[model samples]
Target: SNQSLLTQLLSGDEKFRIASFPTDLPLNGMGSDAPFEFASKQGLMTVMRHVHLVLSRLYPNRPVFMAGRSQGGVAAILYAQHYEDLAGAIAINPPHPDPELFRFTVQYLEDKANVLADLLHAPGVTLHDRSWEAYKTFTPSFDYPSMRSLSPILTLVSLGDPFNLFPQYAHALKAFTENDAKNQLYILDAGHNLWNRKSTDTYREVINLQAQFMVNQISKVRKAC
Candidate 1:
């Protein structure tokens, strides 16, 4: 969704091949129905399945890395959880599915009742009821192996960004990866749209930092392999 806005960042990077999947899908739609979760599993499965097919036909035994931004970030992480072959992942401002955070965000938006929420109904866009219900399913003690088990998940957040800021974001990061020193967190100095010029080039700087970190991660992985 935000990929179009991020074209400048996504483009001109040939060293690492990038693929974009367009949709509001989630990792698995077993019980929830948010626009993102509703389509996530199918979209990720479809993308990975195609990648598998392509690799099978071309170089059958090659390794690959996956990364995603916004909802795409969630998809990337979900894809890695399901696929053991995912070498590494770089997820930027992935949605935090914590119930309290979700509630707070909804209340915050509803309080503002802005055009954005009115036009789109967002996050809870489709399955507003079901998604809220599903969110309640999560608890402080809920076990999230998918997040914590991801050995090399790199999470980036912006201090002023309402989307990724919070106990929920913190929990999501913790859930996906542990407190190991291997985990790296980068805090940018702007709001959600870092690439925006109004942010005084903070977004571009974040992009450069993320790129360097990704390169270092790849090099470390290569050495380990």
Candidate 2:
């Protein structure tokens, strides 16, 4: 679905050797506590470690680029912040860095526990408490300034996202890349997930645009080296 954005990037560029993995979040409507527990700072670190190990083994001394959609986008940004060796990153429609947004999401999941369970086909599922606590500590706002020192990045924000926070996230990224003209904040005319409410043609066009953006950024990184 939305992941096609990443897939398209992989297909669009031959020079880029990218890897994709699941966040293992509980968005499948499977009604499992896994989603809640997996949505934490520790969980993200674990995933990033795995990513680092895999890329280090495969690419050795080569520079690596990271990209993701939504929560995946958040993970990309977080990983880039923690690891300075990355060549760059692309985050599409990432969650706001504000802790309150996470708190609201946790509350909404709790309040709509039954409704989510029914929708996901998990009749007795509820968001786990530990998961909620971990999520609270996963805020990214505190680190944007620090991330500014890392490699170049490109952020894609959809203007019509229902969450209404992605544009703010994009702006935050813009501030982070203020002095660096190579980094960019690209605004698209679509929903939270660009493919979600768009037509097939529009979806393809968006994916193509993202692929081109990634190619350009990677080219810039390559030339500067």
Q: How high a TM-score does candidate 2 get?
A: 0.61
- Stretches off by above 4 angstroms in model 2 are 1-19, 23-31, 35-43, 59-63, 99-137, 140-142, 165-182, 196-198, 220-225
Top-TM-score candidate index = 2
All candidates' TM-scores?
Answer: 0.60, 0.61
Measured over all alpha carbons after superposition, the RMSD of each candidate to the real structure, in angstroms, is: 6.9, 6.1
Minimal lDDT window, size 10, model 2 = 23-32
lDDT of 1 by residue, 113-170 (tens): 3343333323333324554444334322222233443435566776555555565665
TM-score of model 1 relative to the true fold? 0.60
Residue-level lDDT for 20 in candidate 1: 44
